[model samples]
Target: MSSPVPPQHARPKRAMAVVWASAAFVAVSAAVIIVHLAGAPSGAVEPSSYAASNAAPGAPQTVAVGPSSSPAAKPSATSPSAAVTKTAAAPPQEPPKAGWIPVDQAAWQAQVAAFKARKIDPVPAGVGNLPEFRADCQYSHRLADDPIVFPDMPGASHMHSFVGNKAVDAHTKAGDLTKFTATTCKPVVDHSAYWVPTLYDAASGKPVETTGFRVYYRSVRNNSTGIMPIPTGLRMIAGDAKKKVPTPRGAQGQFYCAFYGPGDLDGIARSTNGNWPICGGDATLHFMLQFPDCWDGKHLDSPNHKDHVAYGSDKGCPADHPVRIPALTFDIQYGVKGTTQGYYLSSDTTGRSASSMHGDAFLMWDSDAMNKRTKDCIAQRRTCDNNGYLH
Candidate 1:
């Protein structure tokens, strides 16, 4: 009845609408439940069903978890320990000592003391012939009437002739032999001896006495040809000699004051110019001392030698004797040997041919003679020239 209705079709449509509405409602509820579960904070209890499925009792819980508010914190694994540990600093090292010490220091002092205790026997004094020959004696090319130019001796002959002729003429004119005696020979001046005390430690500031002392000399000849020949001598004198005599390793002192040369002859000539006109040429008779330990021309194993004086055209001989002229140069050496406290004096000339024509003498002296001569010179303020005798 009810309008006989649209029949069963309209009723079925209404029933379908109601079923769709119910399905939609169920879907909306499911979505709401999922969002709530996702939004919940950590450590917060979930609904009963979710808590039972995903969480366990006594576990770490989070509440209201959100985006991190600050940077992640570091763990405590790398933290410093409660107890403190410290290390001490190392000490500095010392510098090394120098090798050379002052002569007054320990090692040098001991050496000097030992040297003083060792007694040296006295040596005999006598005239001795030099076993070697002489050379470097001749007239310079520039000099007139080159006196050294003998047929056999090329260099030394002129020097010999000059000296011999002057000596003979001087004696003849003076009419007295006493003035020309060996003792009358003049001493050389302007000579020096360097003393380098051997120190125990050469580098130290302390002073140490030397174990012994040494005597050194240099003989040089210059020619117009621009050639210069220098020879050197070294002598070791032990400190054990008499207290009056220089001790080998004792304090610094100079034994020989004068270094004789041809120039002295010039002074003598000037003094006696009225007597001998050619006396100036005789100055070559002056000789220098050479020690035994010196370097011989024939020997190569000798110590190295050097000269502080230089060679030049203007560098004239100390006596104003002609430097251009060749000279029969002689050097002397004095020292102690073995256990002898006395001096060992030796002479060396230029070469054999030169010395043979112009002979040279070598002499040894006892302490008495040495002291007497040295004292005599000191008293007179004159230089001691002669070692012993003239060859």
Candidate 2:
């Protein structure tokens, strides 16, 4: 080396060039390895078998690579994200349908025809059971067509009574007649204070006597058609002193008068035994205009009348006394099986009032007849009888 003591400048320049070349080679090798591990670009590097060199103490560090670095090492459809997508895309199911049908018209007409074949009868002349009155009775197509026609009746002028007894004019004077008569009348022959009589007295105007007339009646209507039967009842009351009478209670009064008829049948007087007016005094007679049957068997012993009326001579009459009668009508129709529900007569299209009156004064069917009708109705599907007691 001493013998070759060439120029100092040339020696230093050679050493510098070598150092620069070494640094470039190290940087290039590092870039090649990094590119290979990252899935080398198409023209970046060639596949080769070589071991990586050790980095210098102060050289930059890098992450190590393994066989898992291959591009095909991706997740499959069984992944969590895929499962969530499938679940979100699914839809819910629906429920099944139900079937129903409407009632037929021909069936209803047939029922009406059958009812016409089995007609109703008029009320009897004396006190007795309702079923027995059917022997001598006439049938009418409709309530309006009934032969019994009321005169001087409150709602008769307004055509209210024609519909039923609901539309009676409450503001008129005749209207009061119906109200006073319907009240204070007892429907049953009970020995209670519910039955009050009428008499003229010297003081306190006209006082109602404890013992009087006992009347019972029943009426019915079809809510769907507005058709109904005549109202009817039987009357039993104390007689006057002008004739000899019998009293079970041994009271001073006698039992002379007794009469029964339809709503239009008026001026019914007792002429056989003595001069006894069938319906007289300051009282006006009325039947159980309309009533509903107890389907639940709850009201087996209930009265047929809706309420009682007080007929006073002061309103516009010859007598100066107070009397009681039965008023109010109702419309009743078949309901659900085992149900006692029904409609009221006041709700009919005819309208209702205190003075309103009903047509066709025939007697109501007794318990036996009602039971038979109910059974037949159930068989025809016109009504429901759950207990089978109607049969």
Q: Give the Cα lDDT of each candidate.
A: 0.18, 0.19
Candidate 1, poorest ten consecutive residues by summed lDDT: 1-10
Candidate 2 lDDT by residue in tens digits, 248-279: 11112211111212211122343232211233
TM-score of each: 0.15, 0.17
For model 1, how does the per-residue alpha-carbon lDDT over 242-321 read when each residue is reduced to its tens digit?
12222122112112111112222112221111211111221111112222211122221112111111122224433322
Segments in model 2 whose C-alpha atoms lie over 4 Å from true places:
1-204, 207-391
Q: Global lDDT for candidate 1?
A: 0.18
Query: Candidate 2 versus the native: TM-score?
Result: 0.17
Candidate that scores best on lDDT: 2
Best by TM-score: 2
